[model samples]
Target: MLSVHEITELSEEFETKTPQEIIQWAADTFWPEIAMSSSFQTQSMPLLHMVTSLNRSIPVFFIDTGYHFWETLMFREKIASEWKINVIDLYRDHRWDVFAKQNIRSLPLEDPNLCCYLHKVQPMQKALKDIKAWISGIRRDQTSVRAHAKILELQENGLLKINPLLNWKKSDVQEYMEEYNLPAHPLYEKGYKSVGCAPCTVAIGVNDDERAGRWAGRGKVECGLHTDMFSKKDIADVQNEFHLDITKVK
Candidate 1:
């Protein structure tokens, strides 16, 4: 029940060791219940490499929104093949017939955050169920919401969410990628800073926030997954519409 700042304080106080060390520590900390979620963004390469290279492979969850660009799909396939690792595909329910009933092919254009919560946040919540801890590559410099995000925290999902690279900056990420000789997302060099559903992602211009390109001009920046999940209004909206009831989401 730590406040966000308190959660961040704990992470900062302990200070993360090498990628290899963090994985080993998590093994001891969360044991068989630990899971890692990845987006295959270039910034994630180092940690992904470290975890996948371990003797016992970590569970790598990918939230395949099914709306990704061809390049993204290609990159994911390539990484999975090259790494020879297990990548569990997590997805939103986009069954065409079911979607057609609501006359919605994507997020309700009228309410993009609502769209994001249903398609992205809620699914991920279910996808990570029963896991005592989850790991991610989110960094503090990515955006305002993430700026306060820490390397380890208790997500309102009630899971012990760990962001090992929370303090990493764009520069630290780049250095790690280069040192590991990792392959970056193809669209990354093409100017896409943040990668997501192609329909929702765009290339960032100079001086723009790293994530500003996503859902550009959509009023909301984060897709709801990064917010203070304890907020009554936000959680209620997800529960009422998408059935992400905290009591039953598991």
Candidate 2:
């Protein structure tokens, strides 16, 4: 593994490399210890294609929050099957089942941050615990939080978060999709450019930002996967942002 300073220097050089080149390096460096996550959305096609093409043995983590659209689930199955990619489904810790079940209908609307933490963030954090590297598809132009992200970020836990597509824009995704003949998410044609949990996602006009439909009007642009929240291990650390009472969780 590269030291922090070496990783920072290499990350800088990676800014000038293509997404595929960066992905190849990650695979070469981490191999079986490395994996990638995807929402199986339209914009995720390019990175998914690149990573799997470079190495099919790398596991692809998909957080099955149990709140996804049926279409999204089916689309994930189709792509994984057709491409022969190793898709791994991740779920929230079974410990939260009772609480999550009790507020299933209202969680997403009332406290999206906590809802995401329980379903997406926590599951992903647990899934990557044993993994050394995680490849994400976030682009700088996608959101304000992501705009300042580095190509390679070393987490406090010593995990390497690689953003191969950090510098790519929506145009780059489209061009790659067209060139490789990748299929779009089923909801894409119906104005759903960005897809997440069915409750949090909506369709938007072509001129709208690529992520405008995600957590729209909710003052939430991220689900904590790319933010500081991913590193947090205690619920108390984020209690203020949640509506649920953590004291009663047990």
Candidate 3:
């Protein structure tokens, strides 16, 4: 457990290092207790390759939202088998039938915040319960909300969160992938800049931002996994509106 001052000092020190060097520091500092959380997106290949190269046995968590594209799932399997790394599949504990009963087949359209909470955030929270530290491939330029994020952060739950590729840009990610001959996500070539659940993703034009296609035209940018989701009133309203049993979500 690193103190706040220690974390700040380390973040400054890591600012000048390459992504691989930062990952190596994390591997040396918190090997057995550290795990990587990957969405297997286009930007993820570089970090995934880097971490596995350091320690193949480090757990890699993939939140299986049960609504991901067939291609994404297939690609996940391909990477897992090729790398022979420990890939843990995390899923929401709720039954689909309950959501279906509430006519919530397309929650991302009706209530994306709740949808993300149930599908992505909750599952990830459960997966990280026993983990001391976690690594992600989030880069500063990926989203405005994440633009100011540091390379190292202490999450609200006291877990250490490490973003080794925080300073990387899209071009850097591409170069890393190309240099290693890593395969791109099948949908990336189809114009999907940011891939999440199949329903919430779309193809983007060349002039758009990398995440412009996500939740397209819905005025929603993030899925609540990376950003704060709801206020107390917001949660209560959602619970009341959908007759949702918040207690059962976790």
Candidate 4:
């Protein structure tokens, strides 16, 4: 486990390195215990390609929220097959059953935050429970909440989170994808700058924020996975409301 001081020092060290260099460092530092998370979006392609280039067997986790666009799932299959990457599909366990039991199928409509927690955060926390470190494709420029993110963040649970693309710009991602000949998510052509679950995502127009499409009109910016929006009380209330034992969902 890296101490806070060590994380700070390493963040500074990684600041001078390219995304690939930082990824390589992470692979060397924590290979078997390290994994990458992807949403199969344009921004995630570079990191997925980079991690697989280092080690194809490195686990890549994708949360299947049961609400993703059909194209997104197809893209995941395409990437996994083409790259021969070991992609781990993580889903909210028994989500449909839970929804049925609660007589609620569309939680996002009433409470998007709770829906995200049940479908994304809880499942992800379980998937990453054994992992010592994980790589994410987040860039500081994507959202204001993520602007202050470090290249390396030590989570409260002691898991090390590496954001190799922390310093990458939108143009950098574009160039990398072009250079690598990676396929963009099908929805990208439709102007969905930021992709999440289908219900919470929409197409953004030119001159709009890159993430304007996500959780549009909900006054929500993040999906709770990347931010500390959910408090313990919030989680408890959601669980009680849905009659869900999130930790035992699987």
**Predicted model with the maximum lDDT:** 2
Cα lDDT of candidate 4 equals 0.84
Model 2 earns a TM-score of 0.96
- Whole-model Cα lDDT per candidate? 0.71, 0.91, 0.83, 0.84
Q: Candidate 2: misplaced stretches above 4 Å?
A: 235-247
lDDT of 3 by residue, 1-250 (tens): 6899999999999999998898888888887888999999887899999999889999999998878999999999999998898999988756544763465576778887778776777678777778778898888998888898889988877778899899989999989988999999999989987898988999999889999998989988887666652222334455676687866432
User: lDDT per residue, candidate 2, 103-146, as tens digits?
Assistant: 89998999888889988888888888899999999999998899
Model 4 weakest 10-residue run by lDDT: 228-237
Among the numbered candidates, top TM-score falls to: 2
Ranking of all candidate structures by their lDDT, best first: 2, 4, 3, 1
All candidates: CA RMSD (Å): 4.7, 1.5, 3.0, 3.0
Q: Which stretches of candidate 1 lie over 4 Å from their true place?
A: 1-10, 16-20, 94-97, 100-108, 228-250
Provide the lDDT at 115 for model 4: 78
User: What's the C-alpha lDDT at position 134 in model 3?
Assistant: 89
Q: Estimate each model's TM-score.
A: 0.82, 0.96, 0.90, 0.90
Q: What is the lDDT of residue 88 in candidate 4?
A: 94
